[model samples]
Target: MSAPSTVLVTGGAGFIGSHACAELLDHGYELIVVDDYSNSAPQVFARVQRVAGRFVGAVYELDIRDRQALSAVFDRHTVDAVVHFAGLKSVGASTRRPAEYYDTNVGGTTALLRTMHEHGVHQLVFSSSCSIYGEAGALPLDESVPARPTGPYASSTWTCEGILADVCRHRPEYTVVCLRCFNAVGAHPSGLLGENPRGTPDNLMPFLAQVAVGRRDRLQVFGDDYPTPDGTAVRDYIHVMDTVDAHRVALDHLADGPGMRVYNLGAGRGSSVFDVVRSFSRACGRPLPYEIAPRRPGDVATLVADASAVARDWGWRPSRGLDDMCEDAWRFQRLNPYGYEGSARRPGADRRSDGGPPIR
Candidate 1:
């Protein structure tokens, strides 16, 4: 790693991106953030500054798919590396709007790569998902397994990784780190920032948090007839803090003679829907209401991560457990019932110059 001092973070105001910006600032890297507030709010950067006690270099409200706008970002700053977290992340939504997913996820990645090349910037850390491994092989899947993405979202992620690999193969100067992540839950533990999904929350933990905070009457568990021990779908849930920390570690390793390196970032275990409900019940000091429903289309029964490779490579592992995820997530939900609804918008200077469509 060549000690990158500046980072351009796409989707910086979003859930994981915001946290990563704060983490990077703490590590003494200048930050230039880009997000259109599609799934996030602008006020997030203010809270991020408060947490880090450091001001970001700049923030731009623009869709990354706009090459002209993205190039403007690089033109303004000497971005040494980029941590990309921008995309439509919902699994079900991707299945429904497969075209949107492609136009944004795959298209945005290609645009970002082209811009990076033009500016002579090659190091990149991509926020990928374990969903790309969907329904393939057995439990505790590793990186060696062939990618057989089952859903549109997973396929988009797989496509992005392939694009990065192709770029590396052609341009060995490019350093790319792809983190194939499992379910990312929990908040910063500060209660200031967390997952604030618009309208209906898609992920399991955020939905459960909404129920705990009385935002919803009850959560609808998808299925309880899966072949798992608990007869419910299972997933590996890692705290959001741990997830962002992995990005930082990967960034630090980018200068270590890199072509392309992929690692699985996860807790190396599974948590069922019922198990999360019970955990959140204890965290919120009451049993949240829930009912079993038919399994949603493209939902995986069980997805666990064999993150031993990341541990061996980066010496990083998830220290937080499911209880911690529940506690922290509940804290954020309990503190903000509306989830950044009325929080002030404090995005730094550099508003979008060109009109662009927001991520939908």
Candidate 2:
């Protein structure tokens, strides 16, 4: 039999990346994780090994924008495909720092693509977002809808999709699968890994988890006067594991043929902000404190996914429900109140001053 494919995972030390690494390793694929640790803690590599029961091939603390350093990683490993997940991903932050977002998200992607071309590593599963759909005219947004990104972060992803499309037009050998994911919440069920954003948490799940664990005083309900069932904005929150599984399936689909493909990865159901808070409160066994605030600028009323295309084409489906998402998220937060940084201080845990133990 042929050797297993070696996948290069950008931002592998982050929230979703760490789960992806665990999944990839469990499936017997080699991993070369590259991350700058700018938005993630490096301790995750160790947890990945523990979860997978094997060592990753390698881990490089390098930025994707650094062409030379990234090229060196390519030289050292026989990378077969790439799962690109290393980009600035905050919508609000993107609005404030559009130039920085463009430089990192678009510019970094440009550099990574160039280096991949130089090395002839063409297969890529890009981590795109549904925010690119902006305020869609219809509910249950599908891949066929015209992209109308509203903020810099979403625009950066939209720009990358266009670049990949153009690149594919010129390079038929390249296969790119853009997974326009909806909200990715929850941690791995093992409670070993979860979303651990640096500084204040931006996403609702993490913020809610923090509040439940007393890391934060209360939750901030952004809006409750929108035109929805509960007057709050609604979104499709997919468990992180489900999102990671979609990436794996995308890779397999790409291996079968070489062409550009896009899929919406979501649960195909909408849950309002109040819905999530109630779910999380049940998970934590108490009512979490919160206050309703005015709707933020550019906030969409509802953003659900059709997700029928992926089911039809790839036969992929999300098995986890909203309750599973809440329970797993709270478990991770309750266990690691301070995240991986706190993991080091646990009894018998090997603590490293420079971001956990070295890879493997």
Candidate 3:
């Protein structure tokens, strides 16, 4: 039998990485998932496999910063391209630990690039963030807008973007596409794989899910006095399905072009915090317990996307609405009351977090 065509996915065990892995498998592309399991668990691979229903490729417990280790994987498999998703992403945490964020996010990306160059794998799809826009003066932020990342997390993303741009400029053979994604929320419809943050979550959706499942007390409505409609902050929340689909589109786009490019992936519509809370209440069959709180540092009033370039160039558009996001998230919360831990506790399954939820 012939070896399957493979693509390397760094951080494939993480939330967005796992979804991208499932999407790639559905399209018949074999995968090589590389993860450090620092913020994610090895058991996620089993859940992804169950959702995929077949083994696609290898899962290497490796970090991107370790060039020799990453090179070893490249030596073993024919990696056509890489969907780079490994990085430290918490904004608040990055504020407290900027040096670690720079070392991991920036240093790790440089290592990955060097290894890819050594292995002659040039094509790459980088996971950038819309926070690169900082506080956009315009309503809908476009690709042409200048990026001024206020925090270390966003700064690291911007730094990597510059590095990839320079690499692609010098190495004409390299093909790169940086996707600047906005809020990535919701869960897979199957409720088999979803966003499972370690410890307490800092993001809104994960925090909201905890509250819905009785893990947390209430949602914090940050700044109900902002000058937006309903006096709340507004943000572009893209569904995980749509976010993964954009990744596929970016991969395909790289195949057509052999140079560096960037596109914003988002719903192109901003929803207020109140809007999200109301939607969550409607989806979960109960009112969300929320209280108005002062806005946190570095938060902007409204940040939506202009998405025309991605749609025009890659023929991609976000299909799911706010309602779909809330519904899928509510479903996942209801089914997996204790997240993946709930599945692990069933008879015949190991309760340990390291092992796959023993195939119940």
- Across residues 227-269, which tens digit of lDDT does each residue of candidate 1 receive? 8999999999999999999999988899888699999999999
Provide TM-scores for the models: 0.95, 0.94, 0.92
Q: For model 1, what is the error of residue 219's alpha carbon versus the real structure, in angstroms, after optimal superposition? A: 0.6
- By lDDT, is 1 or 3 better? 1
Q: What is the C-alpha RMSD of each candidate to the true structure, in Å?
A: 3.2, 4.0, 4.8
Which TM-score value belongs to model 3?
0.92
TM-score of 2: 0.94
Best prediction by TM-score: 1
lDDT (C-alpha, whole model) for all candidates: 0.89, 0.88, 0.84
User: What lDDT tens digits, residue by residue, belong to model 3 across residues 261-284?
Assistant: 999989999999888988988999
Candidate 1 regions exceeding 4 Å error are 343-360
lDDT of 1 at 334: 89
List pairs with backbone clashes in candidate 3.
none
User: Which consecutive 10 residues in model 2 have the weakest lDDT in total?
Assistant: 344-353
